[model samples]
Target: MADKEPEALKIRREIGLVGGVALVSGTMIGSGIFMSPQFVMAYVGSPGASLVIWALSGVVAMFAALSYTELGTVIPESGGDFIYILRIYGPCPAFFAAVTFILVVKPFSIAAMAISIAEYAMAPFYPGCQPPELAVKCTAAVMIVVVATVNILNVRLAVRVQVIFLVAKVIALTVIVIGGMVEISQSSAIIVENLNVENSFKGTHYSVSALGMGFFQGLWSYAGWYNLNHVTEELKRPEVNLPRALLIAIFLVTGLYLLVNVSYLTVMTPKELMSSNAVAVTWGNKVFGSWGWIMSVAAALSAFGSLNGTFFSGGRVCFVAAREGHMPDILSMAHVHRLTPSPALIFTTAVSLVVLIPGDFQSIVNFFSFTAWFFYAITLSGLLYLKIKKPELPRPYSVPIILPILVLIVAVFLVLAPIIDDPQIEYLYVTLFILSGAVVYVPFIHYKLCPGLLTKLTTFLQLFLEVAPAEKNL
Candidate 1:
């Protein structure tokens, strides 16, 4: 087998407009919706402000997407922010972003999503009992393998899987909205009075800094709006389709999220919202009577889709990073028959499995929410650099200069909010983790101290593994 010729591989451009939309929306609609409301309400201390922060987060995401359009369209590369930052800033910033994503953000996010999937999947069977912790971790580990296997086999099949879950999740959200509407109509007087009364916003714990922190927390629910951009190379008609899919997905998610929040508010007060860990399930029990278990299934499916999408896009960042010589070369190798980044998928899945043992979902969320926006701020800053440095570059899509500026401001605030609200050592630890990539890069790539060993390893990899044509650095 080692003597067998390596299979030729390249990312197939088969993902269409609908697939693109599904990817973006599927990645964004994770356990965040079910889990984030409580945290946001806790921070903001009111249902009204919680709803407002969600809306504002959506708007910020939309603007960020619009700013990203120019880069995704004009460059049309595989790595999203990695490529953008590389183009504008240099190799160092891009390497840091890729390392942070592959090492910390992506795997932690996947583990959290997988754990949520397992929690919802086991919820009905356990009833009043807490689901076994080992069972949850094992189930999540299995899901990580399943998703990785699907992507390793074929890209189209992976997208198809995403679309199926995406549709199921959408239908589930629609049902919840319809249920909320019915409840509102039946008790219009009470619901209307609850919504209109000024007391709704009169929580004693309201903190301005906490509201900023909450906005960032809610933004986590809207985090993966940029997933499609990560796979631009596989997207059909990326120039025209990328922007359309992004805008549609953002608007769709924003609307669904707002309606879902209103639905929760209609059935439960602000106090109840903060108290319930599973907001959707709570709403379902109140609204659907005996059929409430359906919501648990829906939550599982929602997290499943997000987990799959995370594997689909997150691996590409590592693949691109490796292809550019920032990491091990083996990860850049694509599958011969399927053209998938199989090595990258396997590496990402392995990390997720390791992280599953901890199963601390909220800690994962806090770490990711803080780090992801830091990259966003850096990417937007790079966009500003590109506009000034490469003024003559052809842009297929463009946003007002102010749009990127606005997002950058918000990103900076969100990135700093956690430390400002209540200073923590985790922020410093994450910073060291990100900067640690530089330690590897300096010895491995910049100095090229072990060129022969690295060459032999990459050659050995190619003997058994297929790879696409070497990708060029931006």
Candidate 2:
């Protein structure tokens, strides 16, 4: 195992229980809520099954969270799944994890969130007028730059902004939910014809394959439930608070999601919900008349909070990977004034900006989901490996062994469902792309065979990118 990280390499312990909750909830409650219902309903073809799929998604995520609670506190590192993989599986598999995660998964997610923010913010300004494509991308790029600047300058201020945006997100959901329930009571209109029957939305036989697809879609909406683990090193009383934050955040997000789905059902029929391009905006316009701009603002806040949290937690993945020698050592350095991993943060932001070039949010999400689930399943299975191999490792928190087993089953299904159903060649390309990381690792990292020319090039880049010496006590 590697030596303990020096205090200079450590992150500041400023995130408390509430901030931890905000990180988890705020990140998960993004554009997914506004956009995912249509896809989920399309896959399930029934209002009742759609809700069930959402609730089951929560249960699966909670199980995974419980398993991660043990790892997060016991390891208490900043890299989240990367740290766990390195500890149990060793540097090679961990190297692949870090590379795919930093290069593809996180950047794709940030771009998607930024685009969602742009769409919502632009929607309000242009009523019946389609904004130019250049304006949308420019707005999204500006949002990314602004959020990155906030994180680079002050980590604590970034988190405080996360909490504020999270509050606004909650208020928006509350308004939608309350408004839907009120409408339901006032006008007793049951929208779905065969609510729980097979193919209620479409008059066909029920298909388990379709339900699996719906599960995948719903799980994406719950994607960030484990985000707090990404910053465990920065949390106060992490051993106690990590699990608490996770449980609190997951339960809260789940409740809001179920209520929000029910609210949508109250006003819109299954066909209507499935046909909606912007579900929340459509719901708001139907319910609140011309005062529907609030929903658009709320969606913007959700995406904004998600983008900020992504930058906040995602930089640590690069930092810890650098500390372990998987990345250039310069990436491990933090700014002296803010105690933030400025180089890593800039790297994430720059990659995100580049990802915006191929700007289809659904396509990015599809590409990311397969690789993401692969790492998650591997990381969760590591718990069982560590338990059997190193039983004496002190774990401040532990879940029942069955929880990880069930989560693993669910995770495996999520990983393979899309490929089995659609047989997309792109999935093969994604797999090859992740495996391709080994090409670089075997030559440079394993054998320590970096040429002198490559070293000089990296050094030149590091000169401007990193602080010479990270602060020991900022």
TM-score between candidate 2 and the true structure: 0.93
TM-scores, one per candidate: 0.94, 0.93
Please provide, for model 2 over 163-279, each residue's C-alpha lDDT reduced to its tens digit, 9 standing for 90 to 100: 999999999999988998788778745534335354444532156457666876788788887788787778889888888888999999999999999888878887888887678
CA lDDT scores, all candidates in order:
0.84, 0.83
Over the stretch 114-227, how does candidate 1's per-residue lDDT look in tens digits?
888888888777765558889988888988999999989898899999999999999988988898899998886545654676766767355546866687679889978889
TM-score of candidate 1 on Cα atoms, chains taken together: 0.94
Task: Give the lowest summed-lDDT range of ten residues in model 1.
Answer: 465-474
lDDT for position 435 in model 2: 90
lDDT of 2 at 319: 80
Best by TM-score: 1
Candidate 1, after superposition: displacement of residue 84 in Å? 1.2
For model 1, the superposed segments whose C-alpha errors exceed 4 Å read: 1-8, 204-208, 464-474
Task: Tell me the deviation in Å of residue 428 in model 2.
Answer: 0.9
